[model samples]
Target: MKQGAQGSAATGAGDVPGSAVRVPPQSRGAADADVDVDVEVGRERYDAPGGVRGEHTHSETPLPRPRPAVQRASVRGQIVDALRTALVAGELRPGEVYSAPALGDRFGVSATPVREAMQQLALEGAVEVVPNRGFRVVERGRRELAELAEVRSLIEIPVMLRLARTVPAERWAELRPLVEASVRAAASGCRATYAEADRAFHRAVLALSGNEQLVQVAEDLHRRAQWPLVGGPGLRGRAELVADAAEHTALLDALVARDLDVVRALVGEHFRGAR
Candidate 1:
């Protein structure tokens, strides 16, 4: 499965500047060229509501002197998070031109923050700036994504194994609620919610490993995989959901019991389905 499968480009309808755009080079080698994302992101233009333009105002009634920094930081954090979610959800696709004006309109803010957010995304390798075009999506190919999955497994399963050894019996008590959330969300037919819950379950398992960096990398890979995996075909069926729930159960059991082989096999099975 391709990681973050949506084409990473966004189109701004010619209103944004070219220098603001960045295009990532295609990553797939010869074997994967036939894969194509038919989904288009900017087909219809969304206009701002009448008489309201995209701009932000510093709160005028603020009494505290330190409030300005806090407010600015808060808004900046929101903008960056929104942009990241947009990219991960395929609200933007690769090679599409991103118009700061259009995004500002959609986000109900002025172009400045939109521009700043794009820059931040670019720095994170989430989006790129095109020399002559506005922002475009970064293209991640199938093989590359698969390789990333392999790297993730390498980092994750061992931590799970070590975690199996150290976590006290009482701490094992915490995972059931997360597992229950996965079951319920799966039944509810919300793939996003289910996936998040599912990720939480796995994360909880690894958290016991006591290695923060490894956990962090696993999380980054998982987050990077979200757009592709959720958007995949065969992702919405009840059987798929049930299978995932079962897998989570099996994984948790294996960890609690210190069953290394079961843990490895469960992790492998999960990634295979992802492909």
Candidate 2:
């Protein structure tokens, strides 16, 4: 009914009551006729008494708008995220050199943002800076990845086992959503999303140990293990990702059940397969 009332009220001068009627554009004096009147549907503006515009009341808080610099920073962040994804997917080959301008062209962005993004990757050890050129994807040997996986297992397996024994089933059940998120990401076959979700799930589990330092070290190792390997198996297939994701669900189930034997076996197998 309110919609109908508003629609009829916004029709035109013919619908207005009494002296508040709007004069026809051509019949008004030259000064009045020269004024532009824009009436947008769904954004109707009502004229108050004496030809004044009524003020609209807002019940919601105004959202903050990002400024130009913030927008530029956001663009750079997006490029960094994309580059990391590419690195994980093996789209950026190890030992290969990539110029910011070339990558900028590929991403349809300016070279400045790409350069900034590459600088961030450099910090992350994913790429290294090349003077007078661009960045090169750091070549990671199979040994290096294997070693990282071993280190992660050394740190995480014990903590996970400890948590499985100590933490209540309800706490473990709270992590089901995170495990499901990893499964969804893996199913989509986006290595970047899956990598992040995977890390988040592990980090949540380790956080239950109440040891910030251990969690930080374990997370760093986990991330390094996911980097593209030199001369190793290429980008992992969807089936592989799905299998990896299923292990996450299985591990959570074991943890919730407080099954130490199953948790230990799954954790060991998961890290070994990660290499």
TM-score of each: 0.65, 0.69
Candidate 2 lands at a TM-score of 0.69
lDDT of 1 by residue, 1-275 (tens): 12223354433332334222222223355443323322122232222222222221243231222234466666667888787666644567655678777888988988777888888878767678877566877766667668767877888777766777777656876797887888887787655566678778778777777777867878777766654432333434766777778777777777677788998898877765542
Q: List the residue pairs that clash in candidate 2.
A: none
lDDT of 1: 0.63
Each prediction's Cα lDDT score? 0.63, 0.77
Candidate 2 residues lying further than 4 Å off, grouped into runs, are 1-72, 232-235
Query: How large an RMSD does model 2 have?
Result: 12.4
Q: Write the per-residue lDDT of candidate 2 for residues 30-110, one digit (tens) a residue.
A: 444233222233334443333534322244232233254678999999998899878887789888999999999999998
Clashes of each: 23, 0
Question: Whose lDDT is greatest here?
Answer: 2
